[model samples]
Target: MADITAAMVKDLREKSGAGMMDCKKALNETAGDMDAAMDWLRTKGLAAAAKKSSRTAAEGLVGVAVSGTKGAAVEVNSETDFVAKNDQFQQFVRDVTQVALDGAGDVDAIKAATLPNGKTAEDTLTTNVATIGENQSIRRVKRLEVSQGAVVAYVHNQQSAGLGKIGVLVALESAASNDALQALGKQLAMHIAAAFPMALNEEDLDADLIERERAIAAEKAGESGKPADIVAKMVDGAIAKYRKEHALVSQLFVMDGKTKISDVVAKAGKDAGAEIKLVDYVRFQLGEGIEKEASDFAAEVAAASGVPQQPAPVN
Candidate 1:
């Protein structure tokens, strides 16, 4: 049997908000598997099913640029947050996003596009790195536009024009008035920034994520000891709830918290005197899910100078 340590129990309890003894028992029952232990605790009604949402581990910057019918967003990643704050680097990202808007949303196209100083985007980035003295890369870019409707952009923390840490783009395809659609689009972009919906709809959600959610829901439903029909119904209800929570169009608007987003769009169409459809949205939160190695500059200098380092003190 695997050893169930006190630290493991404590971690589980912290994640689930379960009693320490209950967490320990769950860990023991699951043979020290953290995920299984979480499930065990949930089955025993000691932990909530939503506890797993905290495990996301990614990181990078998100930026958006909008021009008329076209808008583009890009995520540029550096090793540290200090690098993200460099004025030169921020300007670089802002410029690159404009390039992305012009380059058919293709990374390579943006890289090869010419900068104002007669150098390509890639060359400019290299030159900037030499001057700025930090490692940086363009991670990803996405573009959205509508032939008939307005594309609106929002920046969560505005550092300058067309630059911020978290950026969002909302595209509405409609025959609606430009003014009306622009207002609605901006509101929707703000909603996207605040809500962080996983996808445009349930269909666009990640397959692996859907499966993982289903597995967790199934495990939780199985403990009801209901008949097969009832258990299946419970699983379906759980999935529907998850979809409503994660999907953009189906989610309740965070603003009013009463109307669904789909209903909001429908009403906006009426207000605009034409049909308006939410085509797409992109939201980028800075430094999400990126594990960065901590740097110790003094230790690095000492190592270079041939000095020994002291070990960390034990707790």
Candidate 2:
């Protein structure tokens, strides 16, 4: 076995168009022989897979899997929706999501977890990218579980049975019957998909987000020409409202639009003759935060045709 240096691996990745891990493995497999490494990558088809790795992949599916008291959600992105519909790509999302439900709680863990095909998730992903002829990536994974009750999974705008545009999991802890838990969990999951709560509770909201809201509120209050005490009160009120509107428990239930989620859970528990708690939740909207690049199609066509620029008439 040879000691594979970073520079050597970088060289192999450049020449072979393979991922960093694959390049390093190739170098190690061939005792640092660059040509042998290239052959190794080519044999596995890893070299061709990553040639398009630089392309932006913002379209794909969010897959969900649930078992007993646990559930998992995963987002696998592809450069185009056409590729997303590929059978292989959908299977990858399904397999990786099951891995997440089995305890791979994070992106790295899911990638490292082995698939039924005897390939690690990363290897499977690379192989898919090669066969699919598009850049693809496992964007994220989120798992939720409860101690005593149920973890329910839901998908909206589904492309397949459990893969879709929006994936949600709702964890409910209770001694209630499975039927009751399922019903409550489904409604809550549906609410989560539509409402898009930021956190399970107000205190769970991101500190930076809260601070940014506070700053915005303070600036608005400052423009009010009110007394310092009144301005401070206004800022506080704004922050409080923001937190309530964004936190899951404090948010008004989307079902009827009047009941807070906390109250909804309480009523459901009362009807079930037990104490039911909303334990945790995850909502993954595919490509939610990705900034997609916009291309000028007409400009690209003109450039391809080698045509001169034309000015538009004044409106």
Candidate 3:
């Protein structure tokens, strides 16, 4: 049997948010394998989701660049937010984002593209990491283009001109004037940032997410002790509400908080004397879906002193 080391236990504990002893036990059960230990903790409901372990809980900037009808957004992550403020780091993010605008939205392709300094983006990033004294990475890249109309970009809480915590792109496909299309697109991009819609429509939402919601609704409805038909209707109602709340077009516009987004676009198009279609959108919230390690000073002290840590009291 492989011996479980204290460092392994601590690492698993941080990744899974499980108790120290639980992590040690899982490691032992899994023969000191980190991945298997994580799975073991999850199967026992002692750990958070597996994706928590893979979360890029780093700090950096999400940079955006737009060239005429095409726009690109990229997330360049650094070990610390301080590094994000570095001029060198910011410049690298901006350059990479522009590189992504021309390349396919694939990270590998973008990384392989040539930079203005006559170096591959990947090589430049490596040089930056060595020079900046912090590990950094190009996490993701996305591009949006419209055959006509406008593809608008917006940065929320921008730290720099085109870099920020949240970057959004709205692709409007229409024959509308650029002025009108751009105005509507910017509003839509702002809405995307505020609303955080999951998809353009209900049909576009993830099937697994819909199923998970349905299971939760069914379980809640089953506990109500109503007739099966009534319970079924309750579940359906819950799903419908969930779908509307998550879908971009069905969500209420953030500006008015009353008008639906689809209606807003329709009204904007009518006023502009052109038919506008919101083809797609992308919103990248920095460090989103990345679970940061919880800082529990008391728990840390207790663990270090080999004392059992007690759960916090309910408020």
TM-score head-to-head 1 vs 3, winner: 1
Q: What TM-score fits each model?
A: 0.82, 0.78, 0.78
Instruction: Give the TM-score comparing model 1 with the true structure, all chains together.
Output: 0.82
TM-score ranking from best candidate downward = 1, 2, 3
- Point out the higher-scoring one by lDDT: 1 or 2: 2
> Please, what are the lDDT tens digits per residue for candidate 1 over residues 127-201?
877987777788778999788788899998776677767789999998888899889988898888888898998
Q: Which 10 residues in a row give candidate 2 its minimum summed lDDT?
A: 48-57
Q: What's every prediction's RMSD, in angstroms?
A: 3.9, 16.4, 7.4
Model 2 misplacement above 4 A:
1-57, 300-314
Query: Per-residue lDDT tens digits of candidate 3, residues 1-315?
Result: 998776788879978999999999999999998877876776566875454422447689999988778999999888788998999999999999989888658899988899998999999999998998998888888999988888899999899999999999999888888899889988999999887888999999899878866876786678789999999999999899989998999999999899999999999899999899999888988887765554678988999999999877868
Clashes of 2: 0
Q: 31 in model 2: Cα distance from truth in Å?
A: 53
Worst 10 residues of 1 by lDDT: 51-60
Tell me the tens digit of each residue's lDDT in model 2 across 1-315: 788887788767866778999999999999998766765675565764222222333799999999889899999999888987899999999999999989998899989999999999999999998988999999888888888999998898899989998899999999999999999999999999888888999999899878766765676678778999999999999889988988999999998999999999999999999999998998988887675655567878888999965765757
Weakest 10 consecutive residues of candidate 3 by summed lDDT: 48-57
lDDT of each: 0.80, 0.86, 0.87
